[model samples]
Target: MSKPIRNSTEMTDITRLEQANAMMRLVNQALARNDLAALAALGFCHPHIGELKQQGGFRSSSIAQNTRMITRLRKVGDTHAQ
Candidate 1:
């Protein structure tokens, strides 16, 4: 059997996953609000978003993961896009 992930690595992965999920939600909300400027501004600075915007195609799961991060950030008022 494969070795299990250490506790620290697992926690880090969970944190990153949560952040990605929140970002996705924020992107969706911004789109719904017709705030492309805000979306562009936000995505411009994000590593995954920037890469995706440049490439023009990304996996659904990757998009979903980032959306979740945006959503959570919005909920917590961490970004102005909301």
Candidate 2:
């Protein structure tokens, strides 16, 4: 059997990451594209991010990665467009 989580923060992190990974898979399928930037630009992202925030979590720890994720998800057809 798995050991119990050490504390709340640890539990939250575990739960959040697990959720993020699962969500990412579904998001990938929904997007029907592997382009990371594309996924970051739509309403789908809000639901994903909002759910994580509600869980008291972040998209990821790396600021660069978060920016990239957001940039990719933008609604513009051109992934690189500002």
Model 2 TM-score is 0.35
TM-score computed on alpha carbons, candidate 1: 0.46
Model 2: colliding residue pairs: 37-72, 40-73, 41-73, 41-74
Q: Which 10-residue window of candidate 2 scores lowest in summed lDDT?
A: 73-82
Candidate 1 worst ten-residue window by lDDT? 73-82
Tens-digit lDDT track of model 2 for 1-82: 5444344544455556555665655554544444435446534466665564454443335434544454444422232232
> How far does residue 79 in candidate 2 sit from its true spot (Å)?
43
**Residue 41 error for model 2, in Å?**
14
Model 1's alpha-carbon lDDT is 0.57
* Residue 70 C-alpha lDDT in model 2: 43
Model 1: residue 13 alpha-carbon error in angstroms = 0.6
